[model samples]
Target chain A: MTLTAKSITKNYKTRRRQVSVIYDGDITAKSGELTVISGRSGSGKTTLLSILGGLTKPSGGSVFYDENDIYSMSDDKLSRYRNAEIGFVPQGQGALSALTVFENLILPASLSGSKAKDRAEKLLERLGLSQLRDAYPRELSGGELRRLSVARALINSPSVIFADEPTNDLDDENSELVLQLLKEQAQGGAAVVIVSHEQAALKYADVTYRMDSGRLQREEK
Target chain B: MNINTLMLKNLIKRPLRTGVLVLTAALMTAAMFGGQAAAKSMRNGLDSLEQRLGADIIALPEEAQAKTDLENILLQGTPGYFYMNKQVADRIAAIDGVEKLSAQYFLVSANAECCTTKVQIIGFDEESDFTVKPWLKNTYSGRLGDNEILIGSELSTKVGSTLSLYGVECKTVGKLEETGTGLDTAVYATNETVQGLIKASQEKGIAVLSKHDPEEVISSVYIKVKDGFDINDVLSEINQTIDGVQAVRTKSMITGTADKLTVFSKGIGIVTIAACIISAVIMTAVFSALAGGRRREFAVLRTVGFSRKRLSSLVLSESFTVCLAGALLGLFLAGVAVFPFGRVIEKSTGLPYLSPDIGAAAGYAAFAAVAVILTGALSSAWAAYRLSHADTGSILREGD
Candidate 1:
């Protein structure tokens, strides 16, 4: 399966003036490939990922998953798609403070009425969070919390994955672990997209793009 | 975790906020339930009093013209006495519009060394009595013998018990039905039996008992007008013809009581409505603030593929649970205050007060529960909408 964004544009309207954030930005991710979009702050890399993840409605664009346009689907249908097919590991402390580590791991599958307990346990064991399964987000270290978010994104075995700054606030070893996990997901025939500035993530990318001034350019590998 | 589990954890994690919401709901339900119960009790009391008062007109001695005193004597069982000649009954009976008439003698058991409790003693001529005898027949069908007394329903006396007054032992042969009036606290006997008590008192050197001759004086006369006779005209005729006595229409007394009840009911209604409004406003503000803090939490759920409708239902379900708990607590508190102290409330208000039956009280409780729950849901609706419709991407990136 392939996910493609064509001529996507986004604009923000303030009280005084309208500001353009993205202009004709485009990228594609194929099955069994790890795609990376690297950029500086305010380069609209997060906004592009949000649009491609079917979260934000682009000012003008169409995102096609294989043959289906995600934005054209009804709200419920799109929500179901996001739940069963797409996984998101957001930036900066994404685990719910109210839930334990194990609960956060199973939340995505639980939304679709499945327990996923065995899968959650295995993911916790793989992410080295088994000892802290019952601990809340506040009780976990920064790297531990980051791993929990990664473990949650993989619990449902989603066909497509989106990670925004997944290694933020993590040490070198933990960042390497998160990047290796994304590479393993791609090797297991999933389409994985990572938006980050970490230099180590470049080694795992099958295809890389650089975003600058709201424009995406293919990077020479 | 499941959605319900999430909702539960969210509330439990913030006990202080949840407690405030629950307490507000409790206050509202308590005010509403208490006010309605009080109003209903007063209305029931008035209905009971109307049924028990069998006479259309009452003629009392001129000295008993203090209306409040007469009302107190009739309604609260306060003992009082003002005597006119026994011939007053005969004169009232002779009036053209007077279909029937009976005289009553009243005595106070105050400071009586022989009696353990103070009570208003009513002596009715059973042959001429149209009012008290009918009520007396409810519990005792036989003729009331000399020295045989019937106690009011409010008195803690059994049918076979005996009462001693003025050194005379009166056998308690029966009990009267509840009237929700002062009459429920009185003691009733044959006129001859009461005359015996008076003689016993005077012989014992009770100087106050000697002031009035029991055989020659009567306390009040109850008058029933004939069918098809204008009651107002008959009342005017009795008042104009009678000497040293005043005749009052019972309708006027009922109207007066009803006016007071209307005011009392209005006051209760106003207070209940104000409480409801205040609670609703506070709840709305509280829920809004809570939602403001939980914006990202809700966005996280949305990111995990929860539909807007599910988010809304989660908020409403939390509020429903809290309000249901509050409603039950409020009903319990109101029941504790209103049911056991019914008599005290009645006496304090100086109006008739009869508690609603258990079934009716339960129905009121159910209505209050449902109303309170609905109010809570409505109050949380704005918060639910805001949380569900928030921009998920923006909220997730708020502090980034």
Candidate 2:
């Protein structure tokens, strides 16, 4: 499956005026490839990723998964589609603090009425989080929380993955580990999209795009 | 994990919020149940008192009315020993519309000398009596002998116990049922036993009788008017015909007690309504705070693909569980307070209070449970709606 976005625009209305966050952004992520978008803070990298992932509605343009327009689906159908086919890794303490790491990992799959305990155990082992399966998110370190977020995103084994700033608070060793996991997910034939300002992430990206002032530019690397 | 498990974990994460909500609900239920039970008990006590009196008019000596308030004498069981001519019974019996008439004799026991406790003693003419005789028939078949007596249910003495009244020992043949009035504290006997006691008192220098003439003196007369006759007319005729006697209708005898009970019932009702309003307000505030604090968490769940309907269900389920538990706990506490320790409330209020039966208690508990659950659910519904319609992206973006 391929995820594509064209001419996406997002605007925010403040009390004083209406401000544009993203303008005419376009991107495509293909299976078996890692796509990276890098930008400074407030450059709308997260907004663009959110719009492409169907977490937010764009002011203009549309996102399609292999010719099916995601915006056209009803909220209920869209929620089901997202649960069954799309995965999102939000930035900063994304795991629910009330749940254990294991509970968080299986939540996405559980929402769709599918039993994924075996897959959850494998992911825990693969991410070196087996010991922290029963540990609540409050007890986890920043790096541990980031790894748990990644495990949760991959629990449903969706065709497309959208990750925002997954390596923001991680140490260099943990950041490299998380990047390697995303790369392995791409190699395993899922479309992986990462939004970050970390230049070190470029080494693992098959296509790199830089965002500036709500606009996107392809970087030849 | 299931939705219940998820809901429980969320509650456990915020222990203080959960505890406050549960406590408010518990207090509200307790007040409602306890107040209702107390009110019903008072009403039942009044009904029993009215049934036990059963007399259309009570004629007492005019001098006795001057000395003591007859209503107080009946309600608070004040020891009274005034006497009129025994011929007053014949005079009242001659009045028109008088269906039945009985004369009563009164005496009092000194502290620890004549009886185990200080109590008012009543002597009934069993042949002419209509009130106490029918009730006593339920427990005793034979007529009360000269030395036999019946004690009120509230008295510490039991049947077959020997009670010494002014040096005259009498066997307790039966115990009367509770009437939640001064009658519960009285002792009943035949005029023969009362005359014996008066003679004993005279010998002991107690001077209980006005003229030491038990054979020719009676304290009061009770009359039942015919069914079709107006009680007021009978009472007026008796007062007009009789020379030195004052007549009072039994229905008007307990006006003071009834007034006190009405005031108490109204007070409890107002308190119950205030408690309900306060609990509802607190629940609304608590739910709003919960929604605000957990916005990001709800947003996360939504992004993870929980439908708006499912999210709303989760909120409602959590509220229902808490409300049910709190209501049950409150009802249990109310039962404990009302059933075993009801006398405390009675003593505090200085009015008769009886616990309602098991069925009534259960009905009150069920009502409290439904009320609490509905209040909690409705209060939280607004918050749940807002959460269901919240913008997921903004919540995620604004996450701490």
Candidate 3:
């Protein structure tokens, strides 16, 4: 599947005034390739990824998964679509603190009433989180938590993957491990999109885009 | 994980908040069930009293002090007695609207050789009686022979046992059913046996009624008014025409107790409603704060594909579990107070109190449980709505 965003715009309305966050943002992540969007902190990279992942509605734009416009669907239908097709790794700690590591990893799959225990165990082993499978998120280290989040995003084997600074608090070894997992998912015919400011992510990007002042500009690679 | 597991995990992880929610539900349910149970007992007591009191009016000696002594004697089992000339029963019989009349003789037994406590002895003419005999028929169908006696339910004397009163031995024939009234502590026998006891008391040098013959005096008369005749008018005519006797309506004797019951019921209603409302409000505020604290967590769940309806269901499930546990506990507490110690409550209030039967008790328990759970869910509904409709993008991006 291919995720394409066209002419996306977002505005934050407050009591004082409306602040425009995104303007004419355009990006596409195709199957079998890694799409990278890198920018400064306030460049609205997360917002664009949110819109493409169907987590947030765009103010004025359309996101297409193949030929289907996602925003046109109802909230229930959109949630199901995201559950089956998109995997979102939001910034910071996203693991539910109440659940054990294994429980958190299989939560998205369990939402659809499917059992992914074997797949979860495999992901836990591959992410080096096997020993901490029964541990809580609070008990795990920062790198362990980061790896748990990456493993969770890949649990359901979603067709499209969205990772927002997936390696934010990880060391060099763990960062390389997480990037290699994303690259492996892309090689297995998944549309992989990563938002980051890390220089280490550039070597694996099949296509790179720069976000400056809420606008997307492609870089020839 | 499944939704149930997730909900259980959330409650277990936050022990203090969950405890507060459970205790809130418990308090609300306890107030409601306890009040309702007490009110129901009072109603049952009233019905029992009405059934047991077969007479519409009672005529006592003019000096019986109906409010202070008579009510205490009948409602609280404080034994007392007064005497008037037997001719007063004939005079009341001739009054207008007096359809039937039965004369009873009452005497307070001293702490004699037979028993440790003073007891009220009631003697009734077996042929003309309408009130006591009908209830006593359930236990014994034979006529009460001379020297035979019937005891009230509260008495520990067993059937076939003998009770000696004033040097006269009376065989215990049967036991009356519980009426939840002061009458439960009384002993019943034929007027002939009472006359014998009076003679025995006089012979034993007891100073009670020494100058009067037992056959010449009676204690009170139970009057049944004819159908289609108003009871109040009969009461007035009996009081006006009869000398040395005061006529009283049975309902008038019960009116004070009924009024007290109404007030008690109203107070319970008010307190129950207030407690429920206060608990609901507190729960709403607490659940709202909890949802706000878990705002980011909910947003993460949304990203994992939890719909708004699913999130709300999760919240409702948690609240429901807490309420169910609390409701059972509250019911157990209320039952412990209201069921076993019913007689103590009745005596303390100076009113009749009978507990509801098992079937009715079960129904009330079920209703209380459902009502408490519904209240909890309704209180948490606002929190669930806000949590589900939150801006997932903003909350998640805030962490960046």
Best by lDDT: 3
Residue B317 of model 1, lDDT score:
91
Model 1 spans > 4 angstroms off: B64-66, B111-117, B133-139, B203-208
Each model's lDDT: 0.85, 0.84, 0.88
- Scored by lDDT, model 2 comes in at 0.84
The candidate with the higher lDDT, 1 or 2, is 1
Candidate 2 residues B341-375, lDDT tens each? 65566657656655677898889889988999999
Instruction: Quote the positional error of residue B129 for candidate 3 in Å.
Output: 1.7
Clashing pairs in 2: none
Pairs that clash in candidate 1: B75-B182
Q: TM-score per candidate, in order?
A: 0.93, 0.91, 0.93
lDDT of candidate 3 over B1-400, digit per residue (tens): 6756899899998899989998988888889888888889888887778788789998888875744566777788787777889998888888878899999888777685666688888899998999787877345888999989888787888899999899788999988888878788889999998888888888888857776789899988999999999999999998888888888888888899999999989998999999999988988889899888988899889888988888899999999998998898889988998888888989888788888888988888888888899998998899899999987888888756
**i-RMSD of all predictions:** 1.4, 1.7, 1.0
List the candidate 3 regions with Cα displacement exceeding 4 Å. Answer: B64-66, B108-119, B155-171, B195-215
Ranking by lDDT: 3, 1, 2
TM-score of chain A of each: 0.97, 0.97, 0.98
What's the TM-score of candidate 2 when only chain A is evaluated?
0.97
Error of 1 at B179 (Å): 3.1
What value of lDDT does candidate 1 attain over all alpha carbons? 0.85
Chain B alone: TM-score in each candidate? 0.93, 0.90, 0.90
